[model samples]
Target chain A: MVHFLKHNYQDKDYFFLWDVESGSLHNMDSVAFLCAKKRYDKTLSPNEEIEYKKISSKDKDEINAFFNQMEESGSLNSPPRVTYFKKNPDIVKALCLNICHDCNMRCAYCFAKDGSYNTAKEYMTFEVAKKAVDFLIENSGERKNLEIDFFGGEPLLNLDVIKKTVEYAKKAAAARGKVFHFTTTTNCALLDKETADYLNREMVNIVLSLDGRKATHERVRKCLDKTVKYEDLLKKAVYIKEIRGDKSYYVRGTFTVKNLDFSKDIIALNDAGFDQISIEPVVLEESSPLAIRKEHIDEINKEYERFANIYLDRRKTSKWFNFFHFMVDLDFGPCVNKRLTGCGAGTEYLSVSPSGEIYPCHQFVGMEDFIIGDVFIGIKRPEIRKKFSEICVLTKEKCQNCFAKYYCGGGCIANAHKFGEGMDAIYELSCHMTKKRLELSLAIAGIEKLYSINA
Target chain B: HIVTLFKSSLDKNHKTGCGECQSQSCKIHKKM
Candidate 1:
């Protein structure tokens, strides 16, 4: 009757007890964890009960109190409930506009069908871009703040469309009494002063891709001719820093089998004067050389630990750097409670391709099966929207029992499908890495709190 | 009551929002 999940880290068992009815998380120590595990599994052996009773009267009393509290809280007999969102297709608050089907650089791990979605290279026209913006604004329901992200092979390739869309979106949002926020993800290879200035003026949040060290970045993220140097990108990065200031930009990088010790890349990015750095793992086919193998997980775990320590050490001197992942609060169950899945993909959020095809998210843009609607028609597959809205940790059999379920939301749906797993399944490597990262983040957060208190 | 306990225990300055959520297109933002 006691629904809880257990995780073993560093040989210590930690349990998370969920109040199924109320969606609450209770951190439990090993003793209480074992007791609850037995209660939930109905496997309390005779010897185990005797051993539990003999764990000193004080400890026994504490465990009894914990049980009594759970019973009183009505969590003892409650079944786990899946979090569901009533799909309202009209309430779209976020739209990712794939402005360009062609990219300047040909990165090895370019997931957007190798950055062109395997189609003829083209750019989203002003008309299509404007229509996408209008669609977002019209369907945004009563929401005051709506977000439009300019995405593509390289959004900067179609800078004119971005500029025009922003101009139109601003007026449209103002007329409707709604605020609009624009964001863009760029490789920084083509970020000229004019583009940087324009992006700065518009206050567009920029995610700049710079894969740590020069060799690592060049190995995967290279020019079409494979002659682009890291310094060229670094110079542009510095220029964007000067224009956008530090707070408005993030230096995003990726790590793969090529760079397992990516903490060095984090340090490299930090040394390059980027205060906000995010290093991600390269998602590729399992057979791809860049795909993260199981053997690399241990080193990746160590890198996270090293990065956490470096992050803490930097904070002590008031460096004010933030590793994107370590910013989570372990005490908070999940990012959003409204949906059970990791993100609001097909429901609250949707992506529009350059030619006006609608997909669940950016990753599914060119995939035929995921096309949810078009710009002119709106969401055509309400059933698919409902399916995504219904996918939560509870729906994932593995996630329902995972200790990190609340933290990771059962991993990403697209990633699960990438590894030949179902939408409700999570990639095992991602799960392992996420759990390790969460553990490290928890440790760092604890130290950070102590340091703050002492300071 | 449980939500209150969880919230109070949380570091008030801690960011609970996922960075990938802002991207809208990225499902798993944090890669190891």
Candidate 2:
């Protein structure tokens, strides 16, 4: 079948055709699009009657020429194929170390069971962290570049271990002729001058959590005792800005149902001198009060539209700002081509908990069933790896039929499990939101293209 | 071909990648 997807933006229709067997993208004209769509829908056959009731002879000839060209390119042929990745134990690329299970703040919609993962609040010892690093290096195969992310209830809570781990990883990488990149995700509540200086000197990529406005951010992300104010967090953000200047650091915000006009948050962050900002929907149980419902999707879509407008306006004025998700290569298609799953969780990416147990991603840190292995033994159950490796959009029945399957990558596995569904099951709200976001991104790209051509 | 043309335009405007230094260096640089 000739698999392709179509969308209408600003009264202009666009079609994206894909050669499933070759994984190559083909540009489709209106006639080619109709032909491909009808073929996929089984309403038209290759050698069947040309329905010329709606088309003139000229258009019909054009359609026939396009169809013949596509056929010659082997775009219409359905080649038998299977997508699978063989287990290569030595190809670890990225590892997220759950440095500290203890957290200083008690955010309202924290999925990590209030940051401790519902387990005892503790910090990962340097020994366990060192082992995790060693495990990464040993399994890193021929890969020279790797990444280690400092994650936790708040990674700063275990700054000592992080410092040691970075120091060790640097030497270990040098000795093995590998380059290791370090990153940390912090709530910014604990970013003091000393810590900021250390992060700056080490060149660690920092991802700070700051939900848009003070009122909205405080409503969801608050201190355990509700004493740490938004001003305090802002001070840390400014401090990091001062120390790191423009080094790569992202100001990430989570927007729950409580704050649907997330564009305001992006604006606030931009006004606050943060250039790289990303605001994401809070991932919560579908039944949770904070979960984005069907009714909220429309409002969220409007917010994205507003956000896109503001983003374009900034570009027009020569102002510098980047909305994280909006930073997509519309021309080049989805980032991963070989993977069936998004983010390569259990396979390429692994999160090590404070006690040394490993899970697919950071979201699965505390979940026992999701535990794939431990630091000492290394990937205890290869079966779990196989399961995750085998899972792709094709394996997902819903996603197989989704127009946004290639882009969405079957959604997040952690989210699917949160809705009490299998890995292949994506949350309906996420699916809708993602498809809308992709559409908006394409529209924005379209507008930008027009401007560039005029220039 | 349209996508490629669009991508070339975007690249000409320097609106490409994640807008970060791919080198992953420590030195502070202005946002592009």
Q: Which CAPRI category fits model 2?
A: incorrect
Q: Considering only N, C-alpha and C atoms within 3 Å, which residue pairs clash in candidate 1?
A: none
Measured with C-alpha atoms, the lDDT of residue A363 in candidate 1 is 82
Tens digits of per-residue lDDT, candidate 2, A389-414, equal 76777777676555466557668887
Which RMSD values do the candidates have, in order?
6.3, 6.6
Task: List, residue by residue over A422-455, the lDDT tens digit for candidate 1.
Answer: 7867688888888787666655554555345458
lDDT of 2: 0.72
Q: For residues B1-32, what per-residue lDDT tens digits would candidate 1 score against the true structure?
A: 01112322212212233333442222222300
Model 2 stretches astray by more than 4 angstroms? A1-90, A225-227, A242-246, A331-341, B1-32
Residue A98, model 1, lDDT: 92
- Candidate 1 CAPRI-style tier: incorrect
